[model samples]
Target: MKKIKGALALLAVLSLAGCGAGSPSSGTAESSPEGTSGSGAATALEKVEVGVIPIVDVAPIYLGVKEGIFEKEGLDVKLTLAQGGAAIVPAIMSEQMDFGFSNVTSMIVARSKSLPLKMVAPGGSSTGDTKADFASVMTKPDSGIKEIKDLVGKKVAVNTLNNISDSTISEAVKLAGGDYKKVHFVEMGFPDMTAQLAAGNVDAMAAVEPFVTISEADGNVPIFSNYAEPVDDLTVAVYFTSDDYIKKNPETAAKFARAMTESQKFADENPEKAKAVLPDYTSLEPEVIEKLTMPRYYTEVNEASIEKIAEISLDRGLIEKIPDLTALLPSK
Candidate 1:
């Protein structure tokens, strides 16, 4: 592990501007300035910035910062929060961010198009326990969307089109005897889904935490747990970096992977500690944080889980073909 002086100060300032308390929209990438690398090993430490979505699944990254996990690895980590992988992936490709937290579906699509991205570590995953809800399709109690079958011919909102939500929901709908092709999906941010559903703008919305917790608290009824039917114990998201970063800074990438691995293990074993750091990085209330369904965080990149997602993406025509999974992940 290597340490660089003065980098923590910059991280502290970015943390406030990007992930200030009670301000969700403030965490977007506009708040993080592009990092400049100096010369030598110290330069790598100073230039380490990770782009993440402001969601509960990424809690371990915040916890790692607070718990000195990244610091112990001799890396000063600047957290850049973005609304979606669509934004983060482009930044990564442009060399604006060293690493990014992204869903596997999006990364698969990116690799399929020869985007030069590689998964360095696991991000978050489903528990596969039907009782433990990480993501779901929900609607207003009065919306009459009692089952997955009801979603057909309705405008269901998803955070993204032709990604995880679209693929999973389509499979779930099919499993429930619904015509998956007839279901219409509209792209909407998670933060706006609840409001849109309430206003009768969308019949149902696929939501992940803490929106799921927030919507449930607001009396919305969940039609089905998105991870339950289509794929159980799914690897939802992963931490990735551009191929250039790995080639130029292998040591830095390895240190980051090790630190994140420790953080993921800590998060998995100590849910309360992981939850404790949420308020520092997200706009979710403390009460809501306590109630939100936590995603399973793991260290080792699961090839099988990723292959399943890629297979689904291929089936849905989201990607022209399944990209080589072995090359997409770093050799451990």
Candidate 2:
């Protein structure tokens, strides 16, 4: 509880500084679930809605709906795009969304706050490739920042403070024999981070895919893969729902999980298909979309990675206790 309050206090200070966390304010593009409308079988399908962000991590779900995988499971999944997980969590809690896709760190924080959310599927993972992962610790050329350990005593830009950026980066630094507590974190949206990096406002920026690729195009060098180190093939994010919602609709949840697992398998096997459907839901240009780094779509979550994140969260004082994975994670 003390740690949660400290995080909220930090949020207040950051919000007053003009650079803060991204909230859900913009309208989302609505995509039709396969066989939900066109085939005159809409009535037979179980209408489902999920909150998502317009990023490379969500390609599997989009591809699943596109390839009729969800339809085959008797579920009609509608995706609603939000600015970030901050918005999606609320939507799920309020019954506006049936499920949501969010990073494990944020979900852990939510669970620590006693929010009755539960992970239902493995949503995103790192490729375990330092040079070509979905996200990286990006620094400008000749910045003297070459690795995660060097980031100690330097200012790092994260979309949100006290979240995964601090967790993963600190862990990598600790593994490299550096002091994790010496690192400084600042809050700014991803869209604004690259410019800040170029201007030398931040020493290093936790850059995610699309941004990592875009920043690299502008000559910024990657120090290391942010989601890869400390644990290779780390689970970066997850698909989840309100605990109450799951309890009331176990069958629906099971069907969604089965369909999503199939979706992950399909995306894992056909990486091009994942890229091909990006333009259908996002506003990114063809050229940029073509070069975006995609995350691993695994049907199973890396429990060790999740546990490591929980321990880091406890260390960061983001949570008073490590969350109970058995209760929060999907059944194996």
Candidate 3:
């Protein structure tokens, strides 16, 4: 596996557009006061840089940073926003970022290829609503595609090829009684997919929040909730770091995870706070932001949902083999 690190690194290029992460520009934001506690005392709040895409799924982290939730855990959180997993993964590899938020499929692919990575906390989950979810399949209003099965032989735009969008969309079409293998996948970014679909470049798209809401606002219709259509309580993404980071900064890692868990729970229970912070991180309009669907957050990583994803990856030939979940998931 060490000998093939070069080949394995390609897995990092996988996009998180399917998960609705933001554009590919490097922007930084420090939400909490430097080295200050809630009481305004000059206690040291450890500075932490976390690589993340500016998508709806990551609202919890932004909320956590803004609300001083991380500061409550002795962390001064800085969000380093990137467009896709490609940028985040390499940043984590070099210790440029202490941790990253990524779609579970990208992490599974990395672990399967012997890249020493582990999910430290759950970042996001499916809403468990089949009729409505954070991620879905969108088509032009006049496309005549009424259901997932109608997608057969159609060109579907996804954030990246061989990632969650393609896998879950394929499964959805199959469940709809269509020949999943016949579906053609076109690589696209979430930011561009809506326009491309309207321009007739693609028949449909596997879209996530912001886009799902944006597409509908443009008169495009959502035909299926790909994240929920095939699996219940599907785990979409998580926060993670390399084994090297954990080994050198175990305390920091633990603190980050605890803060993240707290943030996720807060976001889930207080959905308004999560939505309120979207403007701070993303460029989406307020109308769209308010209407966008939110993902479920969890303190514990759902091993069952992740295993289902790994199984789909193996069955779809995305990963070489099933990843060792025991080694990949957090011990705590």
Candidate 4:
């Protein structure tokens, strides 16, 4: 996916807007450190760059910035918006980003290839909450596609091929007694999936919020929640960094984890606050943000959920083999 890098660069030029530095590694302004002096003065903060996608699932990261949680933990985080996991992986590998938000499938694939990456924190997860429609398989209302089985011999758009979107949809199709191999998978960006489906360019689309909300508003019908069948309470994505970076900057990594954890707790308790920051990072309107299905943001890494994802990837032949999952986590 070398082409993905160029695509991400173009997308960044067109859509990048936030409180972060213009580039992934451009932020260097530091603040006083964690503790205060006898006179109640704070110490200096360590500056770090984090890469993310402009999706509602990353609201906690933006919330962390707005709430000063990272600053309080002696970290100055610069959040860079990348197109997707394919683009973010290369950035982390090259040290362009200190940490990144990526799906577990990508991380596992990287690890299986011997890339020194480690999961530092949870990005987003599925709690099997029926009321919470974080992701879904959506199609135009008049497409005559009422169920997953109906997708046979049809085109399905996913953000990436052989990733979370494809894996989930494939399992769902199988459970519905449909031939997954008969479904054609098209690679498209999440922001553009709804439009493609609406325009009859693709028969169906696997979408995550706030696009899910957008598509529904545009009269698209959701066949089912994307995470409904395969694995319940799955950890969809995670915050990860390169082992070399972590080895050289252990303290900064820990501070980032602490700050993110605090941000996760705040978001879990105050969904309104999490939703409030979406307008700042994403192009979604305030009305859309208000109605978007927010992902379950957790602080602690779920090894079991990640393992299941790796197993699924192997089963689908996305990865040659499963890597040692524990070795890919941050060292205790």
Candidate 5:
């Protein structure tokens, strides 16, 4: 009876082993029952490090993080603040982050450098109606600066060189018969633009979103919003991850995308819900957020729009050339 019981126990062990209930074959790593392989499980629980520039343009991702949507997608997300869109690509290349929010201009330049940055989501775009989303070259309400033509040889504040703000300002200047080269471009953070303009450090600034709204509140007025001009369709904001990260962990990336897309839908369908959640992730005051005009959230990246930005940059000498976008983007 003892011999028979021992034999039965051995059979049971063998059954479990064949069913992957026991340790993996010595030659192969074991996968958790929760997933297909050890790598698959690892991917699911992967810690996602996301980088963002603090601006209302990126509110959907903020809302996603604040709402725990990434958590719901089996990702542990960490956010790092970047100085501007231009800084985000280098952060991704150095592996300082797995994902980041950046503008199309920077993304194009990075792509031209073969940075391995893949744009996974669209962040925002310009509209014809307002400067509430993107930057507009502005002066004091009573500065008597009626048009972009007035900016020639005057100090202009921009968040960065060769970015959306500068590009928009250049276009606006051309339309107003001002030479962009004559306008002195000053690099300043959005928050500092108004103060600098007020303090007489800058004659005008191309400011975005809440900054534009805040400047208006402070009696600073825009000469022209980018939306009012005919310019290339540029991506105002986008989400990216390294190609290596995506290839190694497709499921994890997909999960992240699903969560972000859902959040975009939520923000689109429920503006008040977005207003309620903005303060949880952004520095914008609730009242300021309430007063701000937000952009429509879009989940999918538009390839044509991205290409247009690259084309514009190339035309405007922001980038020497456009990169092969195939590898840096998902299958359409």
Candidate 6:
């Protein structure tokens, strides 16, 4: 998969406007500390650079851009595209980007390692309504695979280890009264997994987004869905920045958050708006985009969810220990 990055320096230099203003300018500016809230929402920003992945879940960020929400925030915003959240942390930490959409788990994991990260806003939540967004474990009709437990010793595919795919796999294994260690786990991207399954290379897949919707349409029945299991309220998408950037440019940071929050409002109030604007930033088909699962739009990180994911990470040994949740979230 390709990695995406946005230009932080360029966005810090643009002019600001109100929400849904006019044509947004893309500029570069000197770095400064970002805002906390209220007044900071209207604060001027030199430039606001944001990194985004192509998943339909992050449609709000694109909607904000398409609807001129960020432009109206009295700021100039620049968007950098990337393949996944894994690519975003490094750029933010390196000070190459100002803010990026990410899963709270990634931020928690990074924070546990002292990566100097903070989640400034809530992105969205994957609920029953958004259950179809996940990469799921599906079985062919009458495959006798009644539950995740049935997959014991059977072949299963995941997008990556310890990611949403892996997390879902772990949850399913536990839910089905099976053990993760007993299953044969394979790592493959969503596109490759379907073909691999067709060729009999895999038995099941813990898929995400369009793949899940597509898989169901192809006749595979869902054995279990990650979003429906209530494993963790872990954010699948959020806005994050490195600690250094927060310390250096607080005002700029707050401005970026304000702009993002405005975008989130647009997305929440107008699903069609997201459906209309998301194609510019993602490869999802227009029809597929409209059908994809979209979560409640939030611009702040949920501390409780972050804490829960940290515990899960510790249990799975993805992180050495649970992180101090308070330190990982944006200051109130």
Model 2 worst lDDT window (10 residues): 11-20
In model 5, the Cα lDDT at residue 119 comes to 75
lDDT of 2 by residue, 1-332 (tens): 23322322322221111111332234444335445445666547788988877677788999998888888888877888676788788889999999988889888888888898999999879999988888888998889987778999998998877788767888889989999889988878776777788788999898776667667777789999878887767898889998999889999999999999999999989999999987766555666667778899999998888888898889879899987778888876
User: In angstroms, what RMSD does candidate 1 have relative to the true structure?
Assistant: 8.5
Instruction: Write candidate 4's Cα lDDT for 1-332 as tens digits.
Output: 23322233333332222111122222222223365556988765577888887766778888888888887786777777675566778889898889988777888888999998998888777757643668888898889999878988999988777887788788778878999889999986665666678688899988776666667777788887776456777777778898888889888888888888888888878999999887666545566666677778877777777777788889889899999898886456
Give the true-structure RMSD of model 2: 7.4
The lDDT of each candidate is: 0.76, 0.79, 0.81, 0.74, 0.64, 0.63
TM-score of each: 0.84, 0.88, 0.91, 0.86, 0.78, 0.80
Off by over 4 Å in 1: 1-47
lDDT of 1 by residue, 182-294 (tens): 99998866667777888989999887776677677777888887765578578788899988889999999999999999999999999999899776666455667677789
Candidate 5: segments with Cα more than 4 A from true spot: 1-46, 131-134, 175-177
RMSD of each: 8.5, 7.4, 7.7, 6.0, 17.9, 9.1
Of the candidates numbered 2 and 5, which has the greater TM-score value? Answer: 2
Number of backbone-clashing residue pairs for each candidate, in the order shown? 1, 0, 0, 5, 0, 43
Which whole-number lDDT from 0 to 100 does residue 314 have in model 1?
91
Give the C-alpha miss distance for residue 289 in model 4, angstroms: 0.8
* Residue 91 in candidate 5, Cα distance off native in Å: 3.5
TM-score top scorer: 3
Model 1: lowest-lDDT 10 consecutive positions: 13-22
